[model samples]
Target: MLVTRQKTLRRFWYPVMPVGKVEAGPQPFTLLGEKIVVWKAADGDVVALADRCPHRSAALSLGWVDGNAIVCPYHGWSYDGSGTCVRVPQRPESNGLKGRVVPSFPCTVRYGHVWVALGEPLAPIPDWPEEDDASYRRIDQFYETWRCAGLRLMENSFDNAHIHFVHRDTFGDIDNPDPPQPAIERLPYGFVARSDVPVYNNELQKKNLRDDSAVTIRHITARWYMPFLRRLHIRYPSGLDHIIVTAATPIADDRCQVVQFCFRSDSEADAPARDIIAFDRRVTEEDRAVLESTDFDVPLDMNSGVERHMPSDQPGLLMRRMLIELLAAHGESEHTRHDAGRATQEQKSSS
Candidate 1:
């Protein structure tokens, strides 16, 4: 099972860390299994570069930050934000080492997270429009890591069928376990799924609802952007709106970091942030537990018959198909090719 590098996936922007976390020092991070370094320049712009130093192959993250340059700890070589080697202590007056450079990545700060692009990005950083709306109260951000592959996390987030069974204890009602089939619309970038179903609320959430009616219908809309960005919009009958925007960054082939920002139309002062965070934490932990125990590290081919799916799995199926198409388009579908070869070999052996 050889995992091929996803070159096309690298063209999208991925969140590295929270904006507040990146201080004046050199912070090391791994995106798409590539080691990279991030730090603020003198003008307060975020700079991302290959972690390896051009000299002696040292990690630039292991060095310190000068005025606007990163100094190599092994030697006294310093590189500026533009990836140019600006200063060399051993050869200060030598212009030969001035033009030496390291790989620099495009970086931007958005939605309280620092995003980096490993290659030429197809578009700007994806964000939910309501995040900046005056009516929506932005809740505190949360971070979690899953041992599963990044694609699995995205599929899980896009899936509405699993909430009934996997989240029965937190937000799901076991009695009404069936989720209605959603209306899915394909977008230029990704797709959107909308469902009008009975919304189940936990004890904490129930207390916060303005209407304590016996029946409550909610409109749930989920949108997915190219690569690995998702936003969920839940609208209540009482005019309350809740949005969950998540970014799953691939730390490794088998690991990913999920950063979520929640927004609501209700007043934050009425619904304390602590209580909201606690409720979210419980729901997410439940999801994390199930996602980590899955047998496959990545999603299976849509037509491979590796797993069974129902009508409720329409969104997930679409997502998997989209991923396969992207991988094939980029010529990175080695696993798919490998599976076909194995099947052919098995048929020959059987004959």
Candidate 2:
């Protein structure tokens, strides 16, 4: 399903960009069909609001930041963090534009990403424990837009059977096409699946382990949070732990911005960050090429038989079921449509 077509999906916080990049001026981002800007106040508080300027419909991102307000480029109007119009260049300083405001969203920083919710959030931002732990080094790997839906990304991450075919160039091998079945467990936040996948000990593994073993088993514990957050923890024979966290933030109906980061138990001396990133980048590229060539959206209603299924598709099947349940519980009502219509009218009138 198209996330923007549903009101409930907009209520979840989605990462837009890395927090370190939110500097200088308002940076424009597309989150759940909304053109929003992320900037920092003089006091170092992160501010997010609609990218539109109320006076003349200019993009707020094109303007510069002055103290805690973002100045509009078209008419010199400025708005504060709360989206209240604080200054109007065309009018007298004494007269405040009381009713002039821009729509705003809840913004915060977590896991080195700027998360913004287009509407009232249904839950807090999902936590990644290694971010606060001192023993592990967290590396922000990649932040790029992919031509695939968030569900497809999430589904692919949890699918293990594809390793033999989709990733043959990287780490897949026929020596052990499949190792073990995943043990699925439900959680309050989402779900967890534990399995051991046999894989060829590629260059990445050889460097990390410092051994030239032909093959190895990846004891993986996969976790999925509501919406599109994933964590895959893999344990190697040498007691090396590799934890990868991926977030797929919906940008539009057929596109998603993916933020991938990882945590390693070894120090920089043992495993270089560059090597890890390079290997994962290639893996992701393989998935991207195939995903882009296929369907863009995931079929949420599994009963319609929109696509074929197999026994190995259990992870993806459960993913669809969970999202379907979310829709059944919080589908858009008449009141939501009315509010959206009113918001559209207000925007048109302002323009």
Candidate 3:
């Protein structure tokens, strides 16, 4: 069985770029394997449309933004924010072409990122409560591309067991390789995984510590939403609260772009954003080094027994199952079936 990529993953909103990046100029982006151009309208709202010009198939991104419309460089054809071709310089009398339009996507700007839906969004864009909370200060926002599949990065973000081994140099301790079993709470949209974990604070975190005493226990809670959104909350015993909201947008089947926002309730007035971003970059880089080298581009099918699961893998397991369910609900489960069949065949051949 095979499934079209778009059908498998079109119902979710993807963060394509930072809101500031798309100004009065056209910026080209790819989402769900489709080329799109985003620009700011004269009213300052964001707009997204197919990147190609109808006249010459030239990339609209190659052209410039004129007020609220995007002008094609090849033929001086102009398109408005709604994807309507409003002008054709060569044919001034072409009134019949007013109805000619290019493809347009639903775009929304939130959390400092521009989000576009390739298809009708099944739900509203996911949100983090801490983003607007008065107690929590938004500190850092960073973006990076990973060479692994979006699911891989998402699973890594949800995996607590990997910290001891994969991040030993940064924040993990090799001697303590075991983590407590996480409590999983299933929700209508997704699930929440909660556990108490010991954290080894880096120098930057140490500086922000409210208490200088050597306390390592922190309450960790991770909330995962349907396709690829996650919010991780870390509460210290010293009344310091930290949150990380991560959205992994699929760039291709084997690649993704991740936007991360870090927030803290303590020391917001003094904590340096660069230090926090640097720490996150280091940890994500460590994960990227391993994820990019993995053999599988896509996540393993949870129902298939090819991959082993432990108590600590509950969150990732639930995530994979939920993703499979979403794809099936969207009538795109052929890919999942194909993957499972292949895995079964590989196992049988090996045995």
lDDT of 2 by residue, 125-201 (tens): 87677788888999899999998888888988988877877888888864556636699998765799999887886
Q: What lDDT score goes with residue 246 in model 1?
A: 81
lDDT of 3 at 343: 90
Ranking by TM-score: 2, 1, 3
Against the hidden reference, what TM-scores do the models get? Answer: 0.90, 0.91, 0.90
TM-score of 2: 0.91
Full candidate order by lDDT, most accurate first = 2, 1, 3
Give the poorly placed runs of model 1, Cα more than 4 Å off: 1-4, 95-100, 211-215, 334-351
Question: How many Å off is the CA of 94 in candidate 3?
Answer: 2.2
Q: Candidate 3: list runs displaced more than 4 Å.
A: 1-8, 303-306, 336-351
- Distance (Å) between predicted and true CA of 314, model 2? 0.9
Error of 3 at 96 (Å): 6.9
Top model number, lDDT: 2
What's the CA error at residue 139 for candidate 2, in Å? Answer: 0.8
lDDT of 3 by residue, 125-225 (tens): 87678778888788647687776667667778778889989998777888888877788899877888888888787776676664454437878888887
Error of 1 at 350 (Å): 26
lDDT, model 2? 0.83
